[model samples]
Target: MQEFAFELALCAHLERPDRVVGRQLGAAVHGRRVADVCLVEPGPEFDRRAAVTPHTIPPLAIESDAGPGTARPVAEAFDCHPDRARAVAERAVELGFFEREREGASTAVRQTVRYPEQWFDSLVGIENKPDLDRPGDLRDQLRIDASLGLFDEVVLATETYVTGAHLNRLPDAVGVWRFDPETGEREVVREPEPLATDGPGIELLDREPGRAEVRPVTAAEKRRQRRRIAERAYGKGWRTYELPDCERCAPSDAEPADLADARLPWCAWTDGLVRPVADCGPTCPGYEPVDGGDSDGDAEGVPPSEGPEAVRARRSAWEPDPAGVDRRQAGLDRFL
Candidate 1:
């Protein structure tokens, strides 16, 4: 089953490769499930809180074979069967993750609430932005539980799966956006760091109580860490798939690669802008994805692709984009 594919790819999908935009990847396990991972430049970052709230539960709530505390605890609250452990554990993780994120958001909101009226008056930036006072190298101690892709990495269970984006209006502010499956809309969330801490280092220093300055993570550092985690996860061989739609490559086009290119828009793939997946859908034309590179299955039992060559056309091979499209779109569309 590609059951373990998405779980493993969770990390990599979050931290896509470097300068590897405008590419789509589908990978799988045992030819069952897969994950559809795209790298693209999206629109401005909106208030995720303002966006539609995700109805689909996250994976962090499940009970694991490991223990009670973890997302996947050993046996359920009851002594459930071990065979059913994985499924149960996985579900728990998803839900627990949603809750954990909610709790963190709540905490951040509380901290923000404590800001005095005068503080808010002069607040060009968050004076003491959503601060997290963990007692260790938080960046190093991310809880990467039930590791499917890579090991020894920090795991973040935000309410939404990120699309790795930037806020156009606020060029300096980077956004990690996602199309929340539950809400059926886009949402953007904050990464580890943004504002500088009022104190020095991980160690705390005396500062205004309510006016504390939570240190935000650096953009470069944030990108680097995310890339590392994603690389480690993609290193695994589970399957991966996409929800559908790539705005640029045109999923509705008569071609396959353009539809799935990460550099494109989500609609290009899912919205029928490009040709549909030949093998899976109805009215089957029945052609294989010649360029369907490195596939890894997700919960939906699809696979991922590999490398830029998947979308490129060769003299002897059929170009994934059948309209005799621009070769530059295959690579340069990422700027969009």
Candidate 2:
């Protein structure tokens, strides 16, 4: 619960108009390592990428042979099985990344626009350990992140006071930040050194007894994984939680003064930020169910709050909707 609050507060603090921030994203290539938060700094072609779609353009479609010039049969363009290829192509078309055409009996697809290679500048992976004293798997997680070099930089954010011993235990490449979730004040304890993103790196897979399993990730694979991360982040912003249908839920009052407008799930009864799924419902002592039929009654369920999509569109670089490119007419010549 503390970690949840800390993560949300940190995300609110990091969010701005210049970059995009997402939470609980998969950061590893071969292994299953979920980053606490991912900060995506915009590259030179960010505007072009954002104009393509508000949602993620299917990575498979981006990597496939489909181009803007010619419409290729889905089966021919995508290397995957016919069904999977068609499904991915369909999703791409839905997202305005691909334009579909009837090629005789088969379906052909082409990119609405070329995939922007330099859409995102750098990815900063942050691991939130609000309480460093209870540092379960903190060392191992940081080690995997630093060794893999998938992110441009990795940092550990904590509320715990740093000591020489704590710094000594961490990898020199990993940066440290002391963040107070209550006040939204962050102090950088150590600056992170950039990782070798251009070259191959090691990925710690598993460990048992004295032996540890590892894999060597190639540069090409890392590039694909990085793109996947960026797309996922762009599609899934940090405001992933929904407010519970409870009158006591006060999102505006839950966050710090800086983040008062963040619209997090804060229970007035608990007087703290809460995970609506876990901490809410009738089971909770303070859960006052919103009376739907209360036209004049004092009972109020969840207040009419601005949606997360609106908040994200207002606060971040992510576009809620874009005038996407639709090249379906270009493929019409094939019918002629």
Taking all chains together, each candidate's TM-score versus the true structure is 0.21, 0.93
Residue range 1-336, candidate 1, lDDT tens digits:
021222222222333322122112221111111122322211222112112121221112111123212222233332456555445444434323211112222210001011111110100111011112221222212211111121111123233333333122122322233332222233445432233312222212223547632233333433333333232222221123342222123222322332233222122223322222432343334323333422221111122343333422221111223222111213322532
Once superposed on the true structure, which residue ranges of model 2 sit more than 4 Å away at CA? 292-304, 329-336
> How close is each model in CA RMSD to the real structure?
22.6, 3.3
Candidate number with greatest lDDT: 2
What is the lDDT for 114 in model 2? Answer: 84
Local distance difference test values of all predictions, in order = 0.24, 0.87
RMSD of 1: 22.6
Q: Which residue runs does candidate 1 get wrong by more than 4 Å?
A: 1-188, 193-336
